[model samples]
Target: MHGPVSAAWLLVALCAATGAYCLLRMRSGVEEQRLSAGGEALMGFGMAVMAVPTAVFTPPRWAWPLYAAVFGAAALRTLWAVRAAPRHLHHLVGASAMVYMALAMAVAPPGPHHAHGGIGVPLLTGVLLAYFAGYVLLAGARLVPAAGSASGGGSTAAAGIRAGAAGWGDRPELARACRLSMGIGMVTMLLTM
Candidate 1:
């Protein structure tokens, strides 16, 4: 647990929890479906991180392909979200991160001419990472709860969350919880890897 393998596994747990939270919160709105798509993206990446270290974790030979699929699904969902979104930089960041993940898996050549990781220094990859990171921050700042409910009945909507009395729509606290959980998980997975 002191190195990359440990780190990767930790991220796996964090991401899995995030996915679980999304599942629980998915019952909130007409737009809840969009969040589900993003959750799937995170789950795909989490699975990829899990598969990266072991050559026989799954259909052994399909390792890279699995990663490729994760990258693709995540990228596509992000793109769709951005297209459907209302001109928000947060949406753009999420989309960029997905594209970056895909590029990191396939676009880079197998040499110094390509990125070694960390999304490259001065390229779209860097922009993607930054964007995704921003989305994570935005998402964390607002957690959509079930429609018509709020921890504090007097709460108001901010950051896409529409809180109500039935229950909290997306509230910043819930968003923060999701962020912290996934953030911890990402760190853990990266460490294991």
Candidate 2:
């Protein structure tokens, strides 16, 4: 009957725009890498937007199936990717948390699952946020000191070897930025809601 012309839809649109930009920034340069780290958080933010609306907007019969099919598929894909790219810890954690969010809502009573408010209320909301916040913080910690010197320069790469004046610290910034993006997006999503 009623389409999601609600304020929530606006949030989703904002998320989509942010997500795309994040994807792009992830490719920017060694200096922008810290920003790229935020991408995972952005992805989480996008998924949360989609989830909140679908859960709140869907009618009966379709709710469970929708949750299972969409979120489940995304989560599963992320999980598979995690195994395939075991080195990508951000992907792994982001996907795992997404799976947790899906499961959290899947069991709610029929129809407009999000209408209850309990799903996104303080408890679940806090947990969802904490996970993402921690994700961003981790990435920030990893990227600090050198900020934009992924051309090696970070403390993490200092011990290994040296490469020119930058001393391996001037590597790239995307990996680190993606990490921050994920966290920053989480804060944005949480604030928006």
CA lDDT of each prediction against the hidden true structure? 0.48, 0.52
Q: Compute the lDDT of residue 144 as modeled in candidate 2.
A: 66
Best-fitting candidate, measured by TM-score?
1
> Model 2 TM-score?
0.47
TM-score of each: 0.52, 0.47
Candidate 1 per-residue lDDT over residues 92-129, each given as its tens digit: 44433444443444544443233445543545535444
RMSD over all Cα atoms, model 2: 8.2
lDDT top scorer: 2
Q: Candidate 1: TM-score?
A: 0.52
